[model samples]
Target: MAHPVDVHVGQKLKQIRTLRRHSQTDIAQRLGLSFQQIQKYEIGSNRIAASRLFELAQIFDVSPAYFFEGVNGANDSEVTPCNTSTTISKALAAIEDETVKTRIVTFIEDISGMAVGRQG
Candidate 1:
């Protein structure tokens, strides 16, 4: 069985790769590996070494810590490429200006008719 941490890391890899529009073959060529090897890394069938993880971080222009962003958060096992919440969170995180982020949040709330800061 794959370790949870490994799976989470792999999921992150796949997510960022997709967001950056990079194919498995692209990443594999950059790293001088086969696409199948990239596939295994993205599926958690094989664990990534620290050096390779650093290389990936460089390629994606994100910190290595990016892979572990929500590993300790609730419902981590449900994190996947298709998760809208995860996608939104990533988009929000990419925005450096707090004012822009707040406005975007307010816009989303307005369009969705969801009250911000209200919990059921």
Candidate 2:
């Protein structure tokens, strides 16, 4: 089975690639990989080497850590081993319509307010 962290990184990689309007073929060509290989990397079916990951980060113009942005257990101080960032990132990535994105943002804001109210 693929590791959860690897899966999360793969999801993030796909999300960033989509957000940047880069196609699998385009990215693969740049990396000198087959599109199928890119797909595997995006789907977490294959483990990306550290060196290749660095190369990907360059292609995306981000640090290698960017691929692990939503991954949990990155820090020792964070309470609850939850993939909060990953969840949010995935949710946002699924919203293709701008109007839907606006509504989702509003909903999140309202939910955040409710949580704060409960705390207060």
Stretches > 4 Å off in candidate 1: 73-82, 85-120
Clashing pairs in 2: none
Query: How many collisions per candidate?
Result: 0, 0
lDDT (Cα) of model 2: 0.76
- Candidate 1 — worst ten consecutive residues by lDDT sum? 77-86
Each prediction's TM-score against the native?
A: 0.64, 0.63
**lDDT (Cα, tens digit) per residue for candidate 1, span 9-116:** 888898888767688999999999999989999788899999999999999999999887777667656443435755776787688898998889888887788875
**Which is the leading candidate under TM-score?**
1
**Candidate 1 has what TM-score?**
0.64
Q: Write model 2 residue lDDT over 4-55, tens digit each, in one string.
A: 6667667777777876768899999999999999899877799899999999
At residue 14, give the lDDT of candidate 1.
84
CA RMSD per model (angstroms): 8.9, 7.1
Candidate 1 has which clashing residue pairs, if any? none
